[model samples]
Target: MGWALAGRARSTDEQVLELLEPYAGNRHRICRLIRLAGARAARFGPRLAPQEHRFH
Candidate 1:
């Protein structure tokens, strides 16, 4: 799920937020996925842009 959430190239912010809505209930499963999803988002997110600064 998190992979899908992060990997859908054509997906919009609205779509991603909508997909995440069900997981916001704070159940253990949902919470764990939320964290994992966040990490995935960061990995695949705009921080990878060429003009962006990179930290060691």
Candidate 2:
């Protein structure tokens, strides 16, 4: 799968997020989103709710 992604020029992060999108509104998503948002927030300043940054 890793090789396939490299061959296709696909981002692993995008693949992971795509898999997670179907479970949106679930706690799993909440946690993932929180983590992502936290990292971005650290750089940009100010925290945002997970919903503010959808997986699209």
Candidate 3:
């Protein structure tokens, strides 16, 4: 999955907001959700990789 994005260009903040706008209520709420998701990933993502490798 990471490889899929390796060659892709990153979207700007505005583009991200636009893309998520339909599913999300508004810009502020979307930004908050993004922030919370980022924080959760930062905290737990590292631990997940090793566990995933073990399962595979």
Best by TM-score: 3
Q: What is the per-residue lDDT of model 2 for residues 1-56, given as tens digits with 9 covering 90 to 100?
A: 22222333334766655655656668475556657654322134588666755566
Estimate, for each residue in 1-56, the C-alpha lDDT of model 3 and write its tens digit: 11121222455666655566665657567556656665322122334343354544
What Cα-based lDDT does every candidate model obtain?
0.59, 0.49, 0.46
In model 1, where do residues sit more than 4 Å from their true spots?
1-3, 25-56
Better of 1 and 2 by TM-score: 1
TM-score of each: 0.33, 0.28, 0.33
User: Which digits, one per residue and each the tens of the lDDT, describe model 1 over residues 1-56?
Assistant: 43455666466667756777877775467647657766443244355446656776
Best-to-worst order by TM-score is 3, 1, 2
Which residue window of length 10 is worst by lDDT in model 3?
1-10
Model 2 CA lDDT for position 5: 20
Which candidate, 1 or 2, has the higher lDDT? 1
Give the 10-residue window scoring lowest on summed lDDT in candidate 2.
Answer: 1-10
